[model samples]
Target: MTEERNSLKEFFNYLRHHDLKMETVPLKEQKDYQHPDDDVDFHAYRILLLIFICGILKPTFFDNFTIYGRGKFSFYDFLIRYPFYLEKALRIKNKEDKIKDLEIKHYETEEAFSPMIRYIRGPWDHKYPDILNYMVSKNLITVHYSYFNKSQKAFCITLTDLGLETAQKIQTEEPIWTKRMEAINAIFRKDAQNQTIEMFVREHFSTLILGNAGE
Candidate 1:
């Protein structure tokens, strides 16, 4: 009976030491794993949100004061994506000065232009069909395609009345985004009136767009 008691005591001692050590071990931080589809959906929703803001800004219609071509639409999408650049551009009073400042800053450092550089090179046009189709299905926007020939094709997009109303409602609900959109529109509206916003974007980002054309 004494031997058995000692054996039990040793077992308890072993467990006490091992269990306490195990309890003291720190746990590694767990990373949040997002699915690939989640990223796609995130960008899709971002595009939709930007389009909604466009409805409020009215810069979505830059062609003939009623519609905008796909290239022009893509340009606006780029601006909406990187609003930091837009906000900075707004600080400069003159349009030419804004373009020059942006270009200089973009070339100043690789980090400054890396994200914008990557976006300019990305397959943004490939994602357009899916987003535009979904918006059309929701009656938020309409797309018009004109194909005269391989080199003479044109694609236009315009927001629906429902889209504009929904955008206004979103602005009412989200004051932070509303202020950002208003600031963005302040810069875009000027060039949009002259139907030169796309040209402005091209000029503002010539180094990124034109310089990286081969890539």
Candidate 2:
């Protein structure tokens, strides 16, 4: 267990050194970091958005928490709202208020997913196929497919050990470790998917590099 913990610490250090730390607070709180402009932030935002979506789909620490947002998946808002708000800010859209309103409705009213998934700049960035292709190219995941499409309004993909390893590499350095041991204990103790996911989420904002619950 100690060795495993050390390995994860090393991975987090590597990612932080490479400036690839993907959490919201760390990015914003970095002293030397300059705010990214439109195009750059868009790509970054897309990546975080994917992580957030995948995080929510899993059973997480926030599953039982109540969210005050008035959105489509607001029931899932405990997991959804922060990511949506983060994306909205990163986009620097002039229609901020309108966007918020729509996001609320986006999850609430649509039996199917909102069309915004298509807002990805490239077709390759829109759904699961694209994610799988990227992961394969980067050696984070592997799959065989000629084409990809949405299913039940969610993308279907598989995770590799590499991906799982990658997720465990990230570390939390904010608000101290006051609540983390509790969160981690909950994570390891829970056999239930929904309960475990909510626990996993309390410590990490969005990194689904870990295994999926339902799969």
Candidate 3:
């Protein structure tokens, strides 16, 4: 743990060299940093969060997040797995029903899945499915599934084995930076629309895990 702490300190030192205005240690005890419930939300990706926050501050950013996001690898991962939007029309009369059925059978036999998917955003949540599919196609995740919604659009999902393995490897075998990266990505995926979380991270965090985001 001491080695981990020192590495984090050095990461901040490097960031300072890069001209980022991150404040250093303050006159506070470790207890002060801990919440009563030990539950403090953290923010690790400012640029990515900006993708959604730009929306709240400026609507044009929201459209860009969806439209321009089409080209982003993350977004493409969300697209490929389940619905295959390019082939959507001829696919199925009740896609949701079909996917849920598959999920049940898939879960029954599969013992493990890529943990990375769980560490990141989601299986499918309207806009997220597209990004999730992109991750799968890139082999960043193992599987993805989608079901129909009120608009007859796909809504549900299933993840693949590779996804779980990635998550497990990061959470266990990788160094602290990798673990924190996983944690950070997890936070952003949970909510990109809020900047309040980012503010808190900026104010409270004196260190950041700088190891590879994931390796």
Candidate 4:
């Protein structure tokens, strides 16, 4: 068990450094870091997805923790809210007031890594496929192509066994994360309607991300 803990520690360190370090390594050896087909960095993907999953799996009552894609199997909800929630969960100040916490990313390499645009630059950024696709391909999640309101809402998503297992790690290993979930769940419990979650998100996150949008 002690050896395994040490290995996990090393892996986390590798994630923080390896990708950027790859760019600086000898030009002749850069190819070693490149995968044959996948362009997405699985290392960084893990970190980003961890945050995404934490948001998806965050606090809710009766354990109803699913993201609906508004009549399609899309990343709409996750893209718009997860980043905002995760940073605050980490107690990271969100200077962008955006769903994408661009303010937290401070490196040149991180700029190209926007799964979604850092802000409402335009409609195009919102239309781009969300990084959630990577999880789908990895069997971490599955998108259901059915509608709840008779095609009014076409898509939704749920975490797979793999996804749940991954979440268990964070929930067990990170105390703050456990508390964040508890906090979000508490917010939901206090609201009688429970349907006005967007309103609640706006109340807590709007001012930080939007100058006056929440107003």
Candidate 5:
């Protein structure tokens, strides 16, 4: 545990050198920096959240949190995984003076996009656009929709140079987000038992996992 903690710290420090440590930056200031067409409600915190997840899982400015691909990459994956990671990363003590485990270990399974599609936002409630759609609209990402084989169409998500620059800006983001990233990495590292709630999510949304191009 000690070694793992040290390495996580070291990795964070590594990003700090590139100005990824925003422990001193205010949230409002971060909010002030965003694309014009991007919705303030979504961009204020949510976009950065997405970027951070993408950064950690792929660990490269070049890789994207893909929507449809040949690998374990998609917004659906985040929806399913974030809750689990959050529960694992956060620990709370109970009245018994003993630690009560918060992780439910199993989430009631749903299709990956179920939550997002059903998510109601703000006073003028509407289904949020596909996050990738918003990203592309804001010029933060470049996407290619093409068929990988005869029957499989796929969309590959990659960062634009501008997107890459913005990602760098987000690297040194607010402190709470920084800790979340650390916790996420820890959770990902500790899943050595091959335990994942993603199986059903993946199966239910096989189109995403299988790169279902619109036929």
Candidate 6:
């Protein structure tokens, strides 16, 4: 029994030191990390569908005096950040069983690598500007810019006829994606109607938007 115990201790010592000291190599830095949703075509198609479902307007345009005066899904501010919010919404495990399939597996994977970084206003993705530019080059959408205030400029994005047609086809062909868009739209509409968008963001996205305020 003493010999057996000594053998076990020796085995554990081997595991704790020499066995664990097998050659180590430094991990190579990935200079350009690519996310699955980094595909411009994919984002363009999704944004087209979103604009079709929600319509066009500057997201920052809000009237404080009137209650629920703006059109539904017209806020471009929310549209710009929609992908991040959509991913968050889809990742909720407690959602109804009917929409359980909307939980995209890859979104979680993408978040693992290239999670949204907080910006001045909210969470910002690096791919949005490129996707918008690609859409414009393809004539999928049109942008109109105007001055919102003395120092600020506002832009409204609308789909071209081609964009509209393409968005329609996507809506018809991708039923699951269409449902996801509807769910996101409903969430935004509820927040907008209740004038609780700020509160909702604070509650749901506090980590991303509020956690790093000091930094």
RMSD of 4: 15.2
Q: Is candidate 3 or candidate 5 better by lDDT?
A: 5
The candidate maximizing lDDT is 6
Please provide TM-scores, in order, for all candidate models, with all chains considered together. Answer: 0.52, 0.25, 0.21, 0.41, 0.39, 0.53
What's the residue-level lDDT of 54 in candidate 2? 34
Backbone clashes for every candidate come to: 0, 12, 28, 7, 5, 3
lDDT by residue for model 1 (19-131), tens: 85434434566566885433544444444445555533333333222234555456555555555556555765444434432333443333322133334522144556676
Q: Write the residue-wise lDDT of candidate 4 on 1-215 in tens digits.
A: 99999999988799787763434767776665565224544432343333333334424311223445331112222322343444453343322232232333344223323443233211113432444566677766665654334324334455667766775665566554344343333333322221344444355545333234542
lDDT of each: 0.51, 0.33, 0.31, 0.41, 0.42, 0.55
Q: In model 2, which regions exceed 4 Å deviation?
A: 1-115, 118-128, 143-155, 171-215
Candidate 2 lDDT over residue span 71-111, tens digit each = 11121222222335333322342334334333334454333
- The number of the candidate with the highest TM-score is 6
Clashes of 6: 3
* Alpha-carbon RMSD, each predicted model: 10.3, 21.5, 21.4, 15.2, 19.8, 11.1
For residues 1-215, write the lDDT of model 5, one tens digit per residue: 99999999999889988877546767566646554334444442344444444332333322544333422233323433344424422331112211133223344232221232211110111233365567777787666764434555654555666676776576566444444444444444321111232443343333333334331
Candidate 6 residue-wise lDDT, 73-98, digit = tens: 22223423444455555445233443
- Can you rank all candidates by TM-score, best first? 6, 1, 4, 5, 2, 3
Q: Which residues of candidate 1, in runs, are more than 4 Å off?
A: 1-67, 94-125, 145-154, 190-195, 210-215
Q: Which scores higher on lDDT, 1 or 6?
A: 6
Candidate 3, residues 1-215, lDDT tens digits: the string is 99999999999999888988765666573335553222211111111232222211223222122212211223222222222221221132233322322222244233221111322222222334455456546444322122122322222222234433444444454333232233333333422322333333223321211221421
Find the 10 residues in a row with the least total lDDT in model 2. Answer: 64-73
Candidate 6 Cα misplacement greater than 4 A, ranges: 1-36, 56-115, 146-154, 190-199, 210-215
Clashing pairs in 5: 20-171, 20-172, 21-172, 22-172, 153-213
- In model 1, pairs of residues that clash are none
